[model samples]
Every structure is written in C-alpha cells, then in structure tokens.
Target: MAKIVNREEMAQGTIILNEIIASRISRKAKPGQFVILQADETGERIPLTMADTNPEKGTITIIYMVIGKSTARFKDLKVGDEYFALIGPLGKPTHVENVGKVVCVGGGTGIAVLHPITRALKAAGNEVTTILGSRSYDLLIMEEQMKAASDNFHICTDDGSQGHHGFVTDVLKDVLEKEEIDLVVAIGPIPMMKFCSLITKEKNVKTLVSLNPIMVDGTGMCGCCRVTVGNDTKFACVDGPEFDAHKVDFDELGKRLASYLDDEKQSLEAYEKANKQ
Candidate 1:
C-alpha cells in the first residue's frame, strides 16, 4: 500500500496533487516516466506522470485533473489514506542532453508532466524556456515552480486573463523566430501538442511530444496504447510516451483518445450519483 503523505488541491480543486510514499519508485523514477495506480480494489487502473520525485523523502508526487471516475476516487483519498496499488516508473526516460537552447511547452495538466523534464534540461546545461497555457488564468497551475525550473518562463491563456493573452503557440513562434533553438519538447492536450508540433515543423526544429493514449496495463502486453509513429505501430508503454513530434499521427491519436468518452461519462455520472445517494 502506498500511503499518501500529503495532498493539495489546485486550479479551484479540479486538479489534485498527492505525495505518496513509494520508496522504490521514488529512487528510480526519471523525467518522462509514469506510474499506474489504483485507488482501491474496485478502482480502475490509471496512469499518471510523476510531477516530482523526492528520493530522500521516498515520495513521488502526482498531479492530476479530476476528470473521470478513477481520478475522482484518487481525489477522495486524503493525506493519511493509502492506495491499493501503485506500479512503477514505467516508460522511457526523457533523453536529456545539453542540446543548446530548448523550449518546453505545456498546457493544462501537461504542465505537471513537463515540470521535471524542464528542470532536468536546465540542469544538463541547456538554456531552457518554458511556455505554459490554460483556457483562463484560474486554470493555470504551478506557476512559481515552473518559473524556477526554466531559465525563461512564459504563460499564455486563451481568454487573455493573464500572461501573453494568446495560445502558447504564439509565444513559441515568437521564440523560435528570435532564437536558434536546438530542440523543443511539448506535452499537453492533443490539440495543443498537434499545433505546437505543426509550428515547429515549419521552422524545421526538432520536436518531441509526449502522448497520453488510453493505457490499461502499464506493460506493453495490453496493446491498448499503440500509436502510429512514422507509419510504425508503437506501444507507448514500452517504446515511449515521448516520440518525435513530426512522426506522430496526431489526428489518429486524437480520435483514439475520444473512443471511450461516452463510456467514461457514464462511469463518472454513475459514480457521482452513487456517492450522492
């Protein structure tokens, strides 16, 4: 059982951050890896990227938006509560190198996943710039942390509630035009990633995107997370959650992600109704 040592609510309680005691995972987890956790015996297995890991404290922090039934269950667990199961630092770690000027773009909950990677890039002697976005100011998260991790940090809100007052792509395009960036790492909503990749492709800049396809078993055996990259079927669990942005089939991935929305809605509705009863 992984005990929740601390918990905090963010983005008006729609997102939750939990620091769980997982000594083994904390010790080995690297940037870009994820963990599959189950809230209880009857809960659905859900994969969450580690927002941060503290080896000395033997804890792994996960920040997730409470979108469906499984995440709702995760939100209900308090600091003292424990998870029924938590399975490891899965997927390939980010290929960190001092690749000159690098820009990391993140949107919504993807900002959480981008945090560690940005920090690692900066640590590896790369001048890292981070651009984060949300629909509105209130929806943005981890501002101070992301700022600290990046040598240059910018924010964008679709509603112009704060920061650049435009899409992250706007800031990215401006940066790309002004500087000679060696690489770009983008993680966010599929649409945001798709657009970012599109912009980078035009500039001929190397870009990497982290994918969050439907995953069941964190292991590659499930075949549920298979995605087409440059015409090859790749399982995100084993091959990568990160891929060359230009090679990803974003449209196909977007469709695959929505395949179970109706079912997910029904599940969340039933869980909410049952709880209210």
Candidate 2:
C-alpha cells in the first residue's frame, strides 16, 4: 500500500498528493515519467505523471484534476490514507538535453505535468519560456512554480481574468515570431496541443506533445492508449506520453478520446447514485 503523506487542493476540483512509495521507483523517476495508481481494491487504475519527486524522502508528488469517477474517488482520500496500488515510474522520460532555447506551453491541469520538465530544461542550460493558460484565473494551477522554472512566463485566460486576455496559442505565436526557439513542448487539451504544433511547424521548430488518451493498465499490454505518430502505431504507456507533435494524427486521437464518453458518464452517474444512498 502506498500511503499518502500529504494532500492539498491546488485548484478547484484539482488535488495534489505527496505519497511514500518504494524507493526504487522514486529513485528512477525522471521529469516526464508517470505512474498508475488505484485508490482502493474496487477502484480502476489511472495514469498520472509525476509532478515532482523527492528521492531522499522516498516520496513522489502527483497533481490531478477530478474529471470522472475514479478521479473523484481519489479526491476523497485524506492524508495518511493508503492506496491499493501504485506502480511505476512508467513511460519514457522526456528527452532532456541542452537544446538552447526551449518554449514550454501548458494549459489547465497540464501545467502540473509540465512543471518538472520546465525545471529540468532550465537546469540543462536551456533558456526556457513558458506559456500557461486556463478558462479563468481561478482555474490556473502552479503559476508561481512554472514562473520560477522559466526564464519568462506568460499567462492567458479565456475570460480575460488573468495576465493576457486571449488563448495560450496567441501568446505562443507572438513569442515564436519574436524569439529564436530551438524546441517547443506543449501539454494540454488535444486541440490546444494541435494548434501549438501547427504554429511551431511553420517556424520549423522541433515540437513535442504529451498525450493523455484514455488509459487503463498504463502498460503496452493494454492497447487503450494507442496513438498514431507519423504512420506507425505507438502506445502512450510504453512508447511515450510525449511524441513529435507534428507527426501525431490529431484527428484520429480526438475521435478515439470520445469512445469512452458514454461509458464514463454512466459510471459517474452510478457512482453518484450509490454514494447518495
């Protein structure tokens, strides 16, 4: 059992947990790795990337948004509670190197996943510029941490309640035009990542994107997170959660993501009804 040593609400419907797991996995966890966790015996396994890690303390931190039944169950667990399963340091780590100027873009909960990578990029001697966005100010998470990791940080919101009153891509385009960017990494909704890739493609900047397609086992054994990158098939669990953004088939990805929507709604409704009784 993995014990949750600490927990905090970072934003509305989002929670961060500090968990003590086996030292082996924690020691091996890199900036872009993820883990599959289950809240209880009856709970379904879910994949969440490591937001941060403390090897000396044997603890890893995960930040997740409550989007569905399994995630909602996770939110109810308090500090000191134990999780049924916590398996990993899974997936390929972000290919980190001194790539000169790097632009890291994240939206909504994707900011949490991008935080560690941004810090790693900066430490690798890259000039990191970050653009973070949300529906509004209250939905934003990890703004300060992202700022500290980046050479410059820009914020955008749909409702004009934050730094820049526009989409994150708007700021990204402006930055790309004004700067000499060598690499761009974006993590967010499918459409947002698609647009960021589109912008970077014109500039010939190498871009990477993290995919959060529906996952189950979080291993190649399960074909659930399969995505098309270039012309070949790749599993987000084993091959990568990050891939060359320009090569990804965003249209197919968007279609596959909708496959479980009806089932997810039914599961959430059943969970709510059971809880109410």
Candidate 3:
C-alpha cells in the first residue's frame, strides 16, 4: 500500500492532488510517465500521469479530475490514508531534448501532466512557451507554477474569464505565425490535442502528444492502452503514453475512450447511492 503523504484540492475542488509515498517510483519517475493506482481491493485501476516527483521526500504527486467512480474514490482518500495498490514509473519517458524553441500546450487537468515536461525542457536550455486553458479563470490550475517553469506563459479560457478569449489553438496559431518554433507538445482532452496537432502540422513543427486511453494493468501485457501511430499499433504503456502527434489516430482513441462511459456513469451512481446508505 502506498501512503498518502499530502493532499490538496484545486479547480474549485473538482481536481485532487495527492502526494503518495513511493520511494522507488519517485526516484525513477520521469516527466511523461504515469502510475496505475487502486483505491481499495475492489476499486478499479486508473492510470494517472505524474505531476511531479520529490525524490528527497520519497513521494510522487498525481493530479486528477474526479470524473468517475475510481477518481471519486481517490478523492475520498485523505492524507495518511493508504492506497490499496500503486504501481508505476510506467510508460516511456518523454525524450527531452535541447530543441531550440518549444511551445507546450495544456488544457484542463492536462496542465498537471504538462508541468514537469515544461520544467525539464526549460532546464535543458530550450526556450519554452507554455499555453494553458480551461473553461474559466476559476478552473485554471497551477498558473504560478507553470509560469515559473516557462520562459513565456499564456492563458486561454473559453468564457473569456482569463487571458485569451478563444482556445489555446488560437494563441498557438498566432505564435506559429510570428515565431520560429522547433517543437510543440500538447496534452489535453483528445479533441484539444487533435486540434493543436492540426495547427502544428500545418506549420510543420515537430509535435508530441500524451495519450491516456483506458488502461488496465498499465503494462504492455494488458494491451488495453493500444493506440495507432504511423499506421502501426503500439501499446501506450510500454511503447509510449507519448507519441508523435501528427501520426496518432485521435479519432479511434476518442471512440475507444467513450466505449465505457455509460458503464462508468452507472458505476459512479451506484457507488454514490451506496455511500449515502
């Protein structure tokens, strides 16, 4: 069992961040890797990308939106509580390089996954520009931390409650036109990533996207986190949770992700009802 060392709520309590004591995983985790965690013996395994790792503290942080039953259970976990199971440092780490100029785009809770990668890119001596977005100002997270990690930072909110009035793609379009960009990294909802990839592809910028399809065992053996890249099937767990954005089949991934939504909703409802009882 992994002990929860710290917990914080963000995005108006819609998102939860937990720092779990996992010394080995914390020591080896990288920017793009994820962990599979179970709330209890009966809880379903859910994969969450690492938001940060404190090797000195022997803890790995994970930030996730409480979207379904598994995450709802995760949200109920308090500091000093122990997870039933936590396995990680999974997936291939992001290939951080000294690419000249990088624009990192994140949406919603994806900002958590993008955090460490942006910091790593900046540390590698690349000029990093980060664009983050959500529905409104209150929903935006890690703004100050993101700003510190990036050489340039911008915000976008759908309701015009924050920086740019439109999507991150709108700001990205402007940046692509005005600046010479060497690389682009986007992590968000599949649709957001898809649109960002479209823009970056048109600009001929090398782009990488992090994929989080439904995962079971979190290892290659499960074959559940499969994604098609460059017309070839690859497991997101072992091969990558990160892939060339231009080559990914986002449509298929979207469909696959939606496949279990009805079931998930039913499960959440039942769990809530049982809790009330």
Candidate 4:
C-alpha cells in the first residue's frame, strides 16, 4: 500500500495532485513513464503519467483531471490514505537531445506531464521555448516551473482571461515563423494535439505527441492502448506513450477516446447523487 503523503487541488478542483510514497518507483522513474493505480479494492485500474518525482522524499506526484468514474473516485481520496495498487515507471521514456532550439507545447493537465521533459531538454542544452494553454486563467497550471525551465515562455487562454487572447496554435505559429525550431513536443487533449501536429506538419517541423487512449491494462497484453502510428498499430503502454505526431492518426484516437463518454457522465451523476445523502 502506497500512502498519499500530499494532495493539492488545482484548476478550480477540476485537477487533483496526489503525491504517493514510492521510493523504488521514484528512483527509477523517468519522464513519459506512467503508473497504473487502482483507487480501491474493486476500482478499475487507471493509468496516469508521472508529473514529478523526488527520490530523496520517496514520492512520485501525479496530476489528473476528474474526468470519469475512476478519477471521480480518486478525487474522494484524501492525503494519508493508501492506494489499492500502485504499479509504475511503465511506458518508454521520451528521448532527450540538445537539438538546438526546441519548442514544448502543453495544454490543460498535460502541462504537468510535460514539465519534467521540458526541464530535461533545458538541462541538455537545447534552447527551450514553452507554450502553455487552457480554457481560461483559472485552468492554467505549473506556470512558474515551466517558466523556470524555458528560455522563453508563452501562454494562451481560450477566453482571453490571461496572456494571448486565442488558441496556443496562434502563438505557436507566430513562433514557428519567426524562429527555427529543431523539435516540437505537444501533449494535451486529442483535438489540441491533433491541431498542433497538423500545424507543425505544414511547417515541416519534427513533432512528438503523448497519446492517452483508453488504457485498461498498462501492459500491452490487454490491447486497449492500441494506436495507429503511420497506419501501423502500436501500443501506447509499451511501444510508446510518445510518438511522432506527424505519423499518428488522430481521427481514430479521438473516436476511441469518446467511447465511454456517456458511461462516464452517468457514473459521475450517480456519484453526485449518492454523495448528497
């Protein structure tokens, strides 16, 4: 049983941060690797990327949105509570290189997932530029850490609540035109990542994206994390959670992601109703 030593709510509680004690996992964890955690004895297994870690403190932090039934149950967990199961450091890590100028784009909760990789890029001597976006100011996260890792940092809000008054692509396009980008990495909602890939493709910039399809098993055996990269099937859990965005088929990924939307809503509704008692 891994104990959650700390918990924080961000993005107006739409996102929750849980820092669980796992010394072994922390020491071996790398950016882009994830953990499959069960909320309780009978809870479904859910996978989440490691947002940050501290081996000295024996903790690995993960940030997640309260999107569906499992996460909603996760929201009910408090600090000092223990997880049902914590399996970790899964998926291949991202490749880091000093490719001169690199641009990192992160949206919503993905910002946290991208943070460590961005920091690694900076440390590797690549000039890092980061673009972060969310629906509004309140939804924005990890501003200071990202700014610290980046040589240049840009932000956008869909509602113009803060920073640029439009989509992140608006800023990204401007950057791409004015500068030479050696590499681009994006992680976000399927639509946002797809759009980022589309734009980067037109510019002929090499781009990478972190894919989060429906994953029942963190290992490749379940086949739930299958995704098409260049029209060939790849398992996100094993082959990659990171793949060349230009080669991915976002249309198929998007449809598969929405498969449980209705069930999620019904579960959320039931949870709320039960909690009112």
How do the residues 181-260 of candidate 1 rate in per-residue lDDT, one tens digit apiece? 99999999999999999999999999999888888898999899999999799999889999999999999998988888
Which lDDT tens digits does candidate 3 get at residues 172-261?
999999999999999999999999999999989999999998889987887999999987999998989999999999999999999889
Q: For candidate 4, give the lDDT of residue 125.
A: 100
Q: List all candidate RMSDs to the true structure.
A: 0.7, 1.3, 0.8, 0.8
- For residues 117-217, write the lDDT of model 2, one tens digit per residue: 99999999999999999998988988889999999889999999989999999999999989899999999888999999999999999999988887888
Q: Where does candidate 4 clash, by residue pair?
A: none
Candidate 1 off by > 4 Å: none
Position 18, candidate 2: lDDT: 56
* Model 4 lowest lDDT segment of ten: 210-219
Q: Which stretches in model 3 have alpha-carbon errors above 4 Å?
A: none
Model 2: residues >4 Å from true position, as ranges?
14-22
TM-scores for the candidates: 0.99, 0.96, 0.98, 0.98
Better of 2 and 4 by TM-score: 4
- Clashing pairs for model 1 are none
Q: Write the per-residue lDDT of candidate 4 for residues 171-222, one digit (tens) a residue.
A: 9999999998999999998888999999999999999999877788788998
Clashing pairs in 3: none
**How does candidate 4 score on lDDT?**
0.92
Alpha carbon deviation, residue 136, candidate 4 (Å): 0.6
Q: Between 1 and 4, whose lDDT is larger? A: 1
